[model samples]
Target: MMLSLALVCDHALIDQAGKLSVLGIFERIWVERFPAVHPRLHLVLRLKGRRTEIGDHPVTIVLHDPSGREILRGDGMVQIGEPPAGVTEVEAAAILVFDVPLETAGAYHFNVTVDSELLASLPVTVSQMPAPHPTPEGN
Candidate 1:
């Protein structure tokens, strides 16, 4: 007679998972009232289902120029929070203040990963500003 063994696991699994959604550049800024100058790129990440604190999760963002050459790389941590009772909405966010240089004008591609899992790859165009016209003397 042959016998087989079965293993079981038990844990409260959080419904749905977290992932990076939209990644792009903010073409304009409120303070500048025009296009952003060396503006920080914004990355939007969405987490579906109930929120739960998972400690700190490692996240990396890589930016590549139009030529496919790497321009910048950054590492950061993402935190998740639990929702209140009777709430089942998913969490979403827009993370900014990345260290990419706005001066490097060109099409950029972003690669984001979570815990070594590739989450998103987005492309954006960054244009160089032309020479500013001098303000005329007097009104």
Candidate 2:
């Protein structure tokens, strides 16, 4: 299998009809105050299965802090169907939601795995960036 796409977004919504809608797509988290809840994070992944692959598979998503400590985890199943004639691979999409762990500002990693094999890692940064000072208007 190959990871075609992996991303971290603010929100990943799956409708009853199996439609996915994402919002607030971002790669950085800026907290103005200390010890604040980091809120939500959405893991979006797309994988391509080999033509010979066909079955139900488990997909795991793991998040780690800058120190390489695991912070959050999510799991879901993906059904891979046999590819059409002459096709090499088929694609399957998975979306997992996680409330980001509240901690000090630093870089984080969102990892996607299938069948115990790591597919991709998406990096996100959470920093307590200071507010920019306003310049004088009459300058």
Candidate 3:
């Protein structure tokens, strides 16, 4: 199986017709201070496989901090079905929601694995938002 798309976004939706809609796609997060909790974020992944690989595959998502320490781990499964007669590849998609906790400003990573093998590594950078300076009393 191959990872066709791996991204961080605000939302991801799949319609009734198997269409994907992603919004607020981003790679960086700005916070006002350290030890910030990003409320919500989505890790979207799209995988493609051959028709012969039709089955349930174990999926793992691991989040690592800037110092290479494991922060969070999520496990799930994806079911692959037979492709259409004219299509040779099957597709699977998943949206993993996370309330990311950032301890300090640096680069974070989300490592995606399928069936015990690493498929993709997605990076998200967190930086401190600049604080506003004090206004002068007299101009």
Candidate 4:
């Protein structure tokens, strides 16, 4: 199997029809506007078939800070159906949502792995929107 997509978004959902719907997909976030550690987010990953994938596979999604420290880690089994021989590929997907402490602003990373194989690394930036300076005294 191979990684098809990895994303960070404000919201994500798998509809009843087996379709994935995502909103506010972004790589940069303004965190200081909200309370510290507020405004949780989601990480969504999609894997595609290469005819070698079958049954359940171990998948891990890890979030790290700019200092190379792990902020959070999530792992689970992804069930993938085997495609017929010499046939088109299929897909598997997973989602992890968590609140990150946004006390500081910097570059972060989302590392995604399938069966212990490094697949993708997605970059995310966290910065604060600068507050406006107080207006000078009016006449």
TM-score of 1: 0.51
Query: Mind giving the per-residue lDDT tens digits that candidate 2 earns over 72-135?
Result: 8878789888776999878777777666765778888888888889988888988897888999
Model 2, global lDDT: 0.80
In model 2, the runs with Cα more than 4 Å from the true position are 13-22, 83-86, 131-139
Please report, as a residue range, the 10-residue window in candidate 3 with the lowest summed lDDT: 81-90
lDDT (tens digit, per residue) of candidate 4 on 42-112: 88888887666667889888888889888888888999887667777778777788887755678888888
lDDT of each: 0.51, 0.80, 0.93, 0.81
lDDT of 4: 0.81
Instruction: Output the number of the TM-score-best candidate.
Output: 3
> Per-prediction TM-score, please?
0.51, 0.79, 0.95, 0.86
lDDT of 1 by residue, 16-121 (tens): 5633334332433222223344434455454333444334567787877778887778788765455667775534343534545544555677777766777677
Best by lDDT: 3
